[model samples]
Every structure is written in C-alpha cells, then in structure tokens.
Target: MSKIFEVPLYPYQRCADQDQATPVRHKVVVVGAGPVGLALAIDLAMQDVPVVVIDENDKVSWGSRAICFAKRPLEILDRLGCGDPMVDKGVVWNLGKVYFDERQVFGFNLLPEEGHKRPAFINLQQYYMEQYLVDRVRQLQAEGKPIELRGGNKVVEVTQDDERAELTISTPDGPYRVQADFAIACDGAASPIRTMMGLDFVGRVFEDNFLIADVVMEAKFPTERWFWFDPPFNRGQSALLHKQPDNVWRIDFQLGWDIDRAEELKPENIDRRLKAMLGDDISYELEWSSIYTFQCRRMDKFHQGRVIFAGDAAHQVSPFGARGANSGLQDTDNLAWKLKLVIDGKAPVTLLDSYDAERVHGADENILNSSRSTDFITPKSEISRIFRDAVLDLSERYEATRPMVNSGRLSVPCTYDGSPLNGDDCALMPARTRPGSPMVDAPVPGGWLLDRTGFGFQLMTIDENAPEALDVDGIEVKRLALTTPGDADGYLKQRYLGDANSAVYLVRPDQHVAARWDHYDEAAVKAALLKAIGR
Candidate 1:
C-alpha cells in the first residue's frame, strides 16, 4: 500500500469531567470524527466557535469508500481551506460514458462551462479526505482556535433539552459526561444519538447488493466514468469503473440479494470476476472489498430542540449517483454558518431551522435522483426491465430518447427553490441566478467571483461601482467593473448581468443568492438578511 493510504490513529486524550465542580461546556459538540463531522468542526472553528468532535474509531475509514467528489463539494471545501490539497492529490475527470452491454450508447461531459477553478469531479479515497479535514482542524487549533478532536471517544448515551445537550462519552480510561449548547450528530447511518432520540429513517430498501473492490494496477484506462449494463464480463448485472489516486481502480458490481456474501467475497470468487473484466493478461492486486445495500431514507426531521443531524446521520441514498458523501459535505456547508451565527447571538436559535429545511430539500433531491438511477440500473419488475431495455436500445439510434436513459444522474447542487429564506425576485433579472441558487463562479480581476466573496454576507454589484459602505454589520460590499480586469472577457456580464448594466445582489454566508435588485436598496437588503437568518 502507498503511504497515502496508510491509516494514522489519532491519540485519544483524557477530557475533564462535566459532572465535577465547575464543569466545562462546549459551544458545539459534534458526535463523529468522520469527514462530515470534521469538516463542520473545522468550518465552525475558522469562525472562532468552540467545537469538540468525538468519534469511536481512532483511525480514518479503512477502505476506499465515497471516492467521487463533485465540483460543488470541492468549492465548499475550498471555502473551508482544504480544497486545493484534495484536488491536487486526486484524479480529475469530467467525461463519462454509458454502455449497453458491449456497445457504447453515449457519453457526456460535466464541465461544459469555462473559467471555474475546480474540476467537475475528483476521485480520492475516503481516508485521504478525512485526513485532509483532520489536518485542517489541527491547523486551526494551532492558531488558538478552540477545536478539539477526541478519537476513541464514543457517545454511549445522549440526552438533549431545549437549551442544552448532555452526553456520556466512553474512552479507554472510563466514561465521562460532557455538555454542549448544541449537539450535531454527524455519526454514520446507524446513529446512536438519533436512535436514543427515538428517530426513524424512512424510505425505500433496495433488494440488490453491490460489491465494491479497490484494486491496485497499471492499466491504460482513461480517467473517465464508465458504467455498463448487462456487460459480457458481469452477465445480467451492472458494473462501474473509475480511477483513483496511487494507481488504485474502483470497480463496483451489482449482485442480487440472494448471493452468498461469504462465497462472493472470497479471493478466488473475486478473482474470477476481475479476470473476466480485465482479462487474464492484466495482473492486479486487490487492496480492499466490501458489500453494501442501497437505502434512500432520512429522519422525519433534521433538527429537534438543541440536537441536530447532518450527513448520513440525517439521510442516506443509493451509491449510484455518488450522492452519499458529496451531499453530506453539502449538509455541513449549509449548516456551519447558521450554527455559528446562532452561537454568537447574531441570529436567533430559529436560524438552525433553516438549516434543517434547506438540507432536507437537498436530501430529497438526492434521494429522488438516486432512486431513479437505481431503478434504471437495476430494474425491479419485468415492466421496468422492458422499458429500461427499450430506452437503452433507442439511445443508440435516437438522440431524443437518450435523455431518458439515466445510468446515474451525477451529483449536482440542489437549489432551494421554495425555501422560506428566499426573498422577492427582481422581475428583469435572469432566472438562473435568482434567489435560492448557488453563486455561479466567474472569472474576476485577480481570481474567481466566488473567491472574492468571503465568509460573510456580501453585496455584489455588477457593471457599476458598489454603493458607499453601508452601516450594516458583517456585510461586505464588493464592486465588479464588467469589461475591465474585474470581468475582462464579459463572461460575468453575460452569465450574471445579462442585458442589465447595474444590479445589486445580497448573497448569504453560504454563497446562496438571498436577493437581487436593479439598484441597491438598504431596506430590501436588511429585510433579506433578516429572512436569511430565519427571523
């Protein structure tokens, strides 16, 4: 194994008791050291929020799980200060091909636009992702940011009320109690905190199991997503192939639920499958393998009193669309800012409710797309198979029917169209950049438009100078001169301003469009900011 895949165990330290005299209390207690939890903790710490993360495991995830990350998540990571490292260490790809048996049906590209800083997707091991996030947390700690990570610390019991949450954490030494103003459950799908709170995740249970194998080999395969249905190597089932860093290849095989788990996982049984796909000429070594079942489910609510849920703890999706971890990262991105505001008293506690609403909307979009992709890939009934086959057959001949053939709708950021935080839309403004949509990246003078917008509310003005600094607190005013160095080539004007020469937009901390106007309006901006904070 390469050094990049080596698992590093973080030493667990003894924490002071909360039951003792003058107990310590944390502003935020995150109940998982996984990627989502670490990312959220790091984001909060960057904003000077005191956060402590606890996890049962001392090391990162062992195998290559959740390897594909989309552009949106990369941008979110960039905002959190860990994007460049991940992009540098991972394989970048924007092209994907779909195959019907041995014949290629069609191919597509994700990065059809230009001037974006990050690629459409990158393939890196989950361990590396977690490690990068952990490193970011440590860097913040060194800067005197109150971010504490406790590995080997497990939350055995959890209880939360309206104002605070009390948790019993078990370490190597013994169990101790800790309290926090708010508790975020980034724990995996089997969340103990969620179960303790009597929450149930309700959705579809797929009847199929997928066998994923990460093998180390040097093959002349293009760095593109290749998905096959009823391929010759894996008869009557679906298969997926993608490239990972350190010459590792991730291969997934769709196995029916009836197969013997033990029998299929054996080296010999696994060898047969790989040999059939790669041929006897290619030699490879298997690094890891696992079997997983698909489930698209989520809790009835993400927030209950002072306890909240993010990532897999809140929802789950089929692996077909690579929505699992990417969406989880988005959950934290949408949440960390809101949590920080509430903790600082800049916003009411109800601001957290918007996090729940927005993330729930994102989860539902992911589930719907994932479920459709799952159905298309592994048709459950005879009618489903017939229609799937028909679509596949027609895709080769007709371009019109090609859109119906969805191997997997690759992950994309969901827009909170009907979100309560959205403000009134400017009638003449372009609909694509309207309220509730993420800020589209465009080339600016020195960097990208997104790079110019910092971690607070921003007032973006196009084609004209931004109005004089407002008295509003925590809002940054940014002016963009279109056709100049600020927007040299006019892409920003074409994409954002359209035919209008001057417009002002109120962007939220998370970079979503809060409101837009033909001219800057102080009262409208104030109202939009208030709505964004869930007032």
Candidate 2:
C-alpha cells in the first residue's frame, strides 16, 4: 500500500460556525467527501455555489478501489480542472483479451477511432483520484471560492422540511446543528443518510462473489485488461487482471457463491491463488485483499424533497463494466447545473425534477447492463453454463459471435432519450448527437471541443447561421461559432451533421444536447431553451 493513505488531506479543525448562537445556515451541505461528493462540490463551487462538505475520514482510501475510469468521467474531470494530473498518473489502455480454459479466445479494442481528446479508458487507483480532487478543492479555496472541507465530521442525524434540510454533525469537540437551503447526499452505497431517511435500493442482488486482490510485483505483463473463463489456474471459474499506476496489479477471482470468505481473504490463501496464476517462482506481496458480492440496485427516486442523492448513495451496480464510479460522476454532472439554476431562482424548482428524471433513466440503463453482464459471467444453472461455454467456443471462431462473449459490456455515456428536458429533434440530422444525447468530442481549432462547453448553456453552430448570443428570459445562451467545419478534422461534420448541410445545437450545462436543428431559428431555439430548463 502507498503512504498516501496515511496522510490526512483535510484534518478536522474547530470552525466558527460551531460556536454560533443558532444553527449556521448554508446554501448547500454535502454529507460525504468521497469522489462523487468532492467532484459535485467542485462543480457547484465552479458555478459560484457556496458548498460545505463533511466526511468522517480525511485521507485517501486504503485499497485501490474502482481502478478503471471510463472516458466520460475523465472528460468530466477535465472540465473540473483536475483531468491533466489524473491522466498523467493513470495507466492508459484500450485493448482487452479474453481466454476460454487454456485457449486465447480473442482480443478487442475499445477505442478504435481517433481525434477525441480523451482515450477509451484509464486504469487509475481511486486514491490518486481523490487526492487530485482534494487538491482542486484547495486550489479553489485559495482562489477565494466558497467551498469548505471538514474532516472528522460525522452526520448523527438528518431532517428536512419543504424549504431546507438540516443535519447534525458530530465533531471532535462536540455535535452541532447545520442547516442548508438544499442538501446533497453523496454519502455512499450503504448511505447512513439514506437509512436515516428510510430509503433503500430496489433491484437484483447477484448470487456470485469475487475476491479482489491487489498485488505488488515486477512483471512483464502488457498494459491491457485480461480476463479468463475456466482457465487452467482457476478452473471452473473466471479471473480478471488490470494494471494500475504503481507496480500494483488488481486481480479478481471468481470464488463461487458458497465459500469461506474469511479463509479466502487470508494472505496465504491469496498468495496461493497468485502463485497459481503467475507461476510459483514469481515474488509478490499482497497489498490488499477483499471479497465483494454483485449488486444491481438503486433508489426509486434520487431526491426526496430538499435533499438530493448522487453517486453510490443513489445507485449501485456490479463492478464488471467499470460503471460504479463512472456513472456516479455522471449523476453529479446531470445534477449540479439543475440544482444551481433552482438556487439562482432563474428556473422553476420543478427543474430539479428533470435531474431525477434524467439520472434515474441513466441508473436504470446501467443496472440493466450490469445485471446482464453478471448473469452472463456466473450462470445460474448447468444448462446456462453449457450455453455460455458454447457461445465462448463459437466466439473464438466466428467474428459475429465474438461480441456474444460478455466480458462485461464496458461503461459508456448514457443518453436521456425521452427526458423531459429534451426538445426538438431533426430527423435530417445525425442520431448519435441528437437531442438528449451527450455531445460527442472532436478536434476544434485551438484544442478540443468539450473544453469550451461545460458548467453553462451554449449554442454550437456548425455551418449554420445563429447569433453570437441569445437570452431566453433571464437565461443567457452563449454561442460556440464554428463557421468552418473543415478546420476540424471532419469529425464535427460526421458526428454532428450527417445528411444535413448546416446544424445548430442547444447544449446544456452538462454538455448534453437539449435540441438540434438543420438550421438556426430564433423562435425555435428560444422555445427549446425554455423547455430544456423545465419552464
């Protein structure tokens, strides 16, 4: 394990709010200081929203949890002003190979196309990510931004009324009351806030379990994801291998439903398994080891009155597809803007309902995919196992059947297809970049396209006639005029404009397309803007 976890990033200290006459009031109070909480706080603070964050621990996590971060989350970190360090410290890879018993079935490339700013995926430890985010929070504080990080503060109770939410946090000195106009619970999967509020996740709990072991060693393994099905080392089971920043390698071994978890997690037992896979002569040290079960579940609604839930507090999924943290970041992305608008009084409170609508839609999609991946991985019945093996056998031979092998259908950005915030869509334009879809990245003149469209509503004009700016009521819509699509590496034309010659897009604060048209229309753009914010 790295010494980074030993150092406290946000050590607790006595704040003046604790000695106030009454409960100190705040604009927003976040319950957890995990990645989702910190990222959401940063996003809100970046938009000039005053935020207060509280967590029990002040350091990075112990184990290398959630090692694979997908491209969408990396882009989100980029917007949050912390992407460069994460990408620099991460191990980038795009290829993954699968095995059936002793035979190498086939290999697949995740990102075949180029011109996008970020890659398909990067293998980074969760601790490094949290460290960088904490550093960003400190930088924002240095810039005089309204953001506070308090460690050793545990939430003892939670209560909420119509106008605001209240929390009692226990500190080293004593407990004190804090009030917020709105509260966000990025607590965790086993959220104490969710429990105090009488909320629970509703979905499927898979029957199989996997043992996660992070081992440190010097080896010549290539930087890529490797999975094995019924391999010679761990027969009748599955295994996964991934590379991280340090010499640590994360390995997950499928240890069936019924087993002695305590016995399996023993260091000697874990070392035995590693020897089986990497040969007996190799020297390695077990850095971390734990057994985790699969769960595909979520709360029915992300928000209850004034308090909103984001990240693992709102949803949980199997880790096979790298969807857990990635989707949580997307939750923060879908939420911060909507919540900011409501607090600014520029939009109706009902705009927050769109956050619940769009993100719930996203959660359901991730749950569905995660459940399918789990089912494919650990079949319930013998006949199911036979069918799975046959598919793997056929996958090794036929190109069409290769896709049938489900080694975790990887994490991808979700499009809120029927979201209420979505507006007009043109059949003449491209489908990938249509309304309710995430704005695809492309090479622009200076750097990248996503660098310009974040934390604010903007209009992207591609060979289309649109004004430099427009004001719909009090909401200002800035324009990203790209008169020359040819200056871009033709990706803008292919991703945004397929059959249409000219295109205009209404992009939300989170960079999702609210609406698009073949050509710019003043009245249509205004109407779409109104609907996109739930007018």
Candidate 3:
C-alpha cells in the first residue's frame, strides 16, 4: 500500500534564539510564505541568493482559495523547477462557455496556438500550489541553496532606513529582531509593512457579494468553465461552475449586498442552494464554503526604500479573472532577477526601481480588467443591464458581438508597452516577438525554447553560424540554427521571422524580450544590456 498524497504542515521551530547575541543579518528577508513569497524565495535561491521567509501560519491555505493557474505563471513555475508536478496533478482547461438564462451565448479558447509546452490554464487548489512550492524550497535547501522558512512567526513591527530594514517577529516562544539588507513584504492585503509605511491602496470596492463553495462528488461534468447570467435554478443571479482535481467541484453564486451573511451561511440554507445548482438527484458532500466581497486596489508603488512588496501586499484584483495569484507570481518573476543582480553588485540599486515601475503597471492592467468583468456580471443600472442582455443575445449568432460578452476576461500576461527599459525595434522584425513582450515559445532541440531560458539573462539568435567566443558577464547566449534537432519544423523561423533570415534578440532574465535587432552590433548589444540591467 502507498501513502496518500497529503499536504504536510511543518511545525514551527524557534528562530528567535539565533538573534539573541548580535543580530544575524541576511541578504534578503521575505515576510509571508504564501505562493508569491515562496515562489520568489525559490527563484532567488536558484540564483544563489540567501533568503529567509517568515509566515504566521504553519499549514497551507485553509480552503481552495485560488484554483486557476494561468500559462504565464505555470511557465514561471517551470523555471522554478516545480512546473511538471503541478501540471501532472492539475485539471487542464482552455475553453469556456457563457450562457444567458438557459441559452448558450458564446465561447472562447484561451490558448488557440500549438506547440506550447503548457496548457492555457490548470485548476489546482491553492493548498496544492503552496505545498508544491514548499517542497521545492526544501529540496533546494537540501542541496545548500540557503533558503529558510519560519512558520508561525509573524512580523509585529516593520521599520526601515536607506541602508537596511528591521523586522520584529513574534512567535509562540517569544519575540526577536532580525535585520536584512533588503526585505519583501508579502504579508497579504492587510500588510503591516504597507500600513507602517503609510501607503494607501487606492481603488474601488465592489458592492456585490459572492458565495463560493467546494464540493466532493463522483459525477461526470465537462472539464470546462461554465458561467451563466440569471441562471434558471438560481433565478435573478449569476452562477459559475468549474472542475478541479480530487473529484472536487467549485461553484460560485452571485449574492446581492443586502443579504444577511449569518443566515446565508447556515447549513440548511447552504444545502438548499447547493441542491438547486447541482440538481436534486446529484449526490455530493460539502467540502468548504465561504462568502467574500472583493476590491480592485493596489499600493501606488511596490518598493519603498529597502522594503519591497509583492502579491496581495502590493496589489489585489477581483477573483473573476484569476489574476490575483497569476499576476503576483509575475511580480516575483520580475523582481527576483533584478534583486539578485543588485545583491551581486552586477547592477546598480536603481535596477530595483524598475521592478516598481513594471509590476505597478501590470497591477493597474489587472484591476481594469477585473472591474470590467464585475460590471458585466452585475450591471450597475437598468440601462446597463439592457445593453448587456442585447449584446449576449447577439453573441449567439454574430462572432463580432462575442467579444463584448465579458465573463471575466481570463488572465493573460500584460505587455509592458511603454516600459522605460524597452529598446529600439527593427522595422523588418515580427511584431509578436518585439521588445517588452514575453518570449514566444518555439520548438527547440529535445524540448522548447523556454526550457533553456532560465533565471538569467539570455541573448538568442536564429543565425546558425554565430560567433562562439563572445564574452559578456552574467548573460548566456543561445543560437537556434537550421542544423539543430528540433528546428526541422521551421517554427523558430516562421513565428519569430516573417521573411527575414535572422535576427538578434536580447532577452531578459525574466524571459521577457528586452530588445531585438536585424543585425548584431557589439556596441549596441552592450548598451542594451546595460540599460536592461539598470546601469
């Protein structure tokens, strides 16, 4: 017999003893062991940066909080050495259908392209995501990567100056003070660091409420997103249905603001609601349920002097788009490389400032899309509802109107259109693989292009016979030639090049395109490298 796959909750050990004499200074201290903080720690550890993560809880998230993991985040997880397990254990989904009352309106496919390594989205419980990240961190620690996690340790106070930041952590045993050259506040939406620094998270708080429930049932349901406006059983309200692993299902029913929360959560009331949605004959067991009202908000800046913020601490959007955790993981992806370069003294401290600029831009984009989805689900006025119904009715026949029915514009990686670090573009180059966009995947020898591009700067070129002896500090060069094993399909040439033969692309450590050129220039490459690293 084999032991079942159960998420382990490690016990909290006393770390306050180490701070008794002289404070042990660390290179980077991460507060909060949530998905964002853990992923960031893993990324920095892979880059050989010492990291200590402190969290107030010893267990994974209590419920199935964030279930949808998008492709961009899965790619980031792949770079962190844990993507395969997630994909193996998750329920992959790409297509979603929208319905108005009882009629099907329109549908969309998230990843319509081929030859990609990962799927459009994977619905794994948030607990499983955290468990996998913690396991990866432990594996890296066994190999001496200098990653430390202290659960049940909460930060009581945070103070920072230009040189360093100090955190006062309280545990069951006692309290201790730890100092670090730089600290990241991943402590969640009600962040102590954000409050201590007097930063305001400015955005709109939606008036509508939603009831989310997780159920265990042995039923055959299509593994696709199904959303309905004014569903038949749950009259005059919207409902959503999705499938997850472990014979579990997630359902969300829209509830207006004026309902009594205490009465709605009663077992009898919840049973009646579940029976209506799942039907009278379907047998199911309730796993967990919760009520929530979301807000679309973020701190104006992610970094404040020596203390940086990521995840729910820096920004949060409505749960409709699945952007909450996906965007947060992207935050760590953008920050880890820059922070490592800054710590290694290879780049100026100003490089960290770009993390602030780029991630804040990403946060704003998520908030905008979340707001639009909320408005469509719960129309503000009678006129707005009339317009929304008209569009849904038209979407059934016309392909053009399908774009207007917003059942949460699913999460996609945001392109940094006007980023300060973007370099000049070549007119002849393909637009999809241009500067400031995430690198498009193409077939490569043995695997994919992204497999070779890890957590470091890479210079990619399609020129077969490029020079082999060019030396640049901290930057790896990969050449995709026609003679390579996987280039037989010509995907590298067709997707990256239209009619041109070859081009040089300066790719950042985060796998985003920094710059591209028709021909390589030593002087131009060095300048773009410097600009990319924030010289």
Locate the minimum summed-lDDT window of 10 residues in model 2. 483-492
Residue 201 deviation, candidate 1, in Å?
A: 0.2
Q: TM-scores, in order shown?
A: 0.96, 0.99, 0.96
**Predicted candidate 1 versus true structure: per-residue lDDT over 1-535, tens digit per residue:** 5454555556677766634665367799999988899989988988888899999887878888889999989988999999989999999999999999999998889998888898899999998898888888878888999898888888988887778998888888878888899999999999999988889898998999999999999999999999999999988899999999999999999988898999999999899999999999999999999999989999888998888999999999998889999999989888888888888877889888888888899999999999998888889899999989989989988999988988889999778899989996876777778899988888877788777764688778775556545545553444433443467677777667766767788888788888888776778877887887787
Top of the candidates by lDDT: 2
Error of 1 at 40 (Å): 0.3
Clash pairs detected, candidate 2? none
* lDDT comparing candidate 2 with the true structure: 0.91
Predicted candidate 3 versus true structure: per-residue lDDT over 164-251, tens digit per residue: 9988888888888888989999988888878887887989999989999888888887899999998887887799999999988999
RMSD to native, candidate 1 = 1.8
Task: Give every collision pair in model 3.
Answer: none
- Candidate 1's clash total is 0
Task: Name the Cα RMSD for model 2.
Answer: 0.9
Q: Of models 1 and 2, which has the larger TM-score?
A: 2
